[model samples]
Target: MQDTLILKGHILHTPSPTQLVAISHGYIVAVDGVVVYCGKTLPSSYEGLPVVDYGDQLIIPGFVDTHAHAPQYCNRGLGMDKELLPWLETYTFPEETKFNDPEYARLVYSAFVRDLWRHGTTRSILFGTIHKDSTVVLMKLLEEAGLSALVGKVNMDRNSPDFLIETTEQSLADTKAWLEASKSFGPLVKPIITPRFVPSCTSELMRGLGELAKEYDVPVQSHLSENYGEIEWVSALHPESDSYTDVYYEHQLMGQTPTVMAHCIHLSDEEMDRMEETQTMVSHCPYSNVNLSSGIAPIRKLLEHHIPVGLGSDISGGHAVSMAKVLMEAIGLSKMKWVEVDNQYAPLTLREAFYLATKGGGTFFGKVGSFEEGYELDALIIDDTSMFDANERSLEERLERWIYIGDDRHIMKRYVAGRLVEEPK
Candidate 1:
């Protein structure tokens, strides 16, 4: 069953971190939702194919959000003054507690899906609260909206407020049920194991969740060493473990499965070595770090170590939905790190940051976030006419300006898996 579509536009994509390939008046040929050709001229064999042409608009890969919280959508920009631990106590937990009502979950999850669509986030990895029913509501909404995401049902059985904590038995049972139910979703929406963090989940809960992850063969997502308070708390909680990363590894959470850990701002040298050895991915959350006064992640060092890296909104804690803005902030933060650390870390160029937002994060999703042949055709069509000046601009300049200043209004259309995604009803 082949369904072929052709689109003509000013094409741009990063085949590698340092390479930005641009083709003027390019043609993209996709068959069955995967790219087959992207170049300035179409092959003669396909000359008769009908083409949808956008005269002067820009075409680029859609953004991939590596970490975010669906339960925290309503809490965006509300608790910026508090650090990670207290923020969770005062604002995060209370708001997440509201998800006990499925109606409330529908209202917030629906709006959150629309926000992701509007911002051109074709794919994301998200955290849902511990309530199984409410998390399912989120998965259904994302599926309906034609977005792709790995949404987790959070598991935390200890050290949490009574209102939000689950007993260890109930936690495992609920998670197993949720994993089974997630089978109802389309290919785009799936489940991931989520333990809130080491401090919130007891060793028993983590072990059970790890075993479930292996049994189901699903990937995992969780918070890492994001702040000084969080790191110290993990140390105190798991005194027997060598470090925060070690606790998860000891519990069979990291090396045994594909895992993405958020906000690795303070990883030790040994932890870094272990992360590389285990092939774990780091979700670099720049805005959340700044908002919570968490220190900057040493992304350049991580890159040099050949560790995988990507950008995340970490919404509510991050306060933004747009990965374009997230990548911009990543570039800015890297500059600060360069100066403050005496040039130990060179600042990221725009191309490098763009790569992080796209293919870097997209790697977790398999062939997503690129315009290369065989890559999933997740794309954004940009109408940057409003930002244009009388003076001519190159494609790279236009893309840079859009990344810095463009919003949803400039996004004329979005596509996930080569299917046009309309705004959700």
Candidate 2:
């Protein structure tokens, strides 16, 4: 493949949360995997560069799914009527246990990656079950398909079912091995330490993993304050901690490394202060929050605190994989928070939601989620003619329609690191 490529399309990207940069007919030039130029017209200096003209199609930064469970793909859209704990026991754990079989993990993860690409997700932070080999299988599939990800071998030493539990010693050993094995993957396919959450991981295990994270210089991802029941359970489990965020901090999981805690829907003022102080990130999963009857996150407040916040699919908990769908749910849920709870926490703008799905979440992966110069070109090409978000709508209006109603069918092509990503066979 040529190192230099040019593309012409209707483009949309967010350089800032409040700003939506759109060009009705724009051209993007990339070379050696970095975007060199993106503007309304083809640069005159590059006269002969081959241009892939996707006339009238929407070209936006690829969506980033900041938190997803690869093993739970099978359980999506099923058992959603129940809340968090019961749903996990009945559907999630049993389904995740099936990953002990490598072939099962292979099938599920392959389909999951293809679906992620089909839905225009170019990067993600994904969780695998406790099976070490199966988790590696997920990483390999992601690497093969040209997707960027932080794939973790889940760590849970207690409070899990007997079939899924691990000894603290065994868990730490497996995690070290998993990290060592991940060195073989492409640069984009890195490993992260995942302790599952406060309830599942014992303090000893979290401390060990925290040490490993520091030693290896790897980032971490986990759930936080997702459910009231889960919070109560964590409180009961670790009474010495001042708050849910404090538990992770006390164990050295939050502040010592890059950490993203999902579904921060319920947090105390002190917890918020700690999160803001530590520069800890939050993966806001609006669909999961509402689906599990968890309270809507105070996203406006988080943004107000200048804390880094991004959108997540929260797979299985969130029934959809498309960030477009997540964006819609996020905006609607924000409205509920504003009218139903506090007017000071106003509803989120469409621009802000798009930023969360793209640039905001992309910050986790560094220099992704935009067409800015020198940024890796992970982009999506879309044909939204059929949806008509509105008939003969302006480019911005069409984008809004896509956010409100588009699906994978609207995505014509996807690219990661300037290389086109094909759907898995």
Candidate 3:
């Protein structure tokens, strides 16, 4: 039962947020898609196995995108001038509404999966629209593509445009059916309960969805405190609640289930405490926050508080599929906050940003995002040598340049769960 692959290169990974484990002359051995050995030199116990020598290439764990809209991949870069609410109405919903057609879902989802792999994102948490058939298509495409992901069927019952709105009863029914039918899909591709956001869902709908989440024991993902208008709207709609985070806590949408909240930009001190206390994950979408003018998230503070933080390419709003781009943006945005907002917090380090892009986000999927033994071998091999001058560049500098400037052209090979994803010729 052991099919082994030995990759020799410059290995770089963060085993923990504060620790960077790099082996300049490293050898990683994966047996049946899981890393069994990773060290500076190959052990003699496995001397004769064929090795894939990446030479000077940099080997790192595949990126984990904690938030994305599968249906809105088509909307990237077209509606950058707008903010959250108007962006939703003008660009997002209209494109998502089109997913009611199964063929369109198949076409776009296939491309989205290809692009995700091309960009070194082997695992993700994705959003699909309310249409059940297309949601199934999206799941099938990701499953077929061998990507590890959680794709959700977004739920919205009230205040949405008529074209996209669903009755409270129908929304829950569809979500239940989707969860039940997910048994046949690949183990890596599963469902998450997605309620869109507080402004869009009725109180009754949220409670019912919460009940389903408990009944099915599934993880949940939704937007939280992204835009100023959205936050005020959540407060206005739920007056009894103290803050936007309190609304979800009141409705059983927070703390009880495994949760990932996107865009915690406008979080209050109390909300931040609540998130840390309850072990909630924050998906920092800096590009989307800047593009939508939704203020920068205090990620340094979040990490200081020891809250689980991860990077998300909130596609369309983010305008890029590459986690490499998002990683650089995260560092840049953190520096902006440090200088303009608070100097004591300091700018994010490349090591910390790398952790968020990989292991930090990969936490939701259990043992992923690193080369440590027993971790899933979800990884990428990059040839950024072309981007570097002939002068010797350290392993660290090459990675930095790749984060800020390199593209898919640098990704020579990709592996998800230890299996290579060969680009279609």
| TM-score versus the correct structure, for each prediction | 0.99, 0.98, 0.98
lDDT of 1 by residue, 108-158 (tens): 999999999999999999999999999999999999999999999999888
* Consecutive 10-residue window with the lowest summed lDDT within model 1: 337-346
Please, what is the whole-model Cα lDDT of each candidate in the order they appear? 0.94, 0.91, 0.90
Evaluate residue 351 in candidate 1 and report its C-alpha lDDT on the 0 to 100 scale: 94
Clashing pairs in 3: none
Q: How many backbone clashes does candidate 1 have?
A: 0
Q: Can you list the residue pairs that collide in candidate 1?
A: none
Q: Count backbone overlaps in model 2.
A: 0
Candidate 2, position 73, lDDT: 94
What tens digits encode model 3's per-residue C-alpha lDDT throughout 118-232? 8989999999999888988888887777888998999999899999999999999998888988878977898999999999999999999888888888988999999888888
RMSD of each predicted structure: 0.8, 1.4, 1.2
Clashes found in each candidate (C-alpha, N, C closer than 3 A): 0, 0, 0
User: Over the stretch 105-174, how does candidate 2's per-residue lDDT look in tens digits?
Assistant: 9999999999998999999999999999999998899888899999989998998999898999999999
- Which ranges of candidate 3 are over 4 A from the true structure? none
Model 1 scores a TM of 0.99
Candidate 1 at residue 303, lDDT? 92
- What RMSD value applies to candidate 1? 0.8
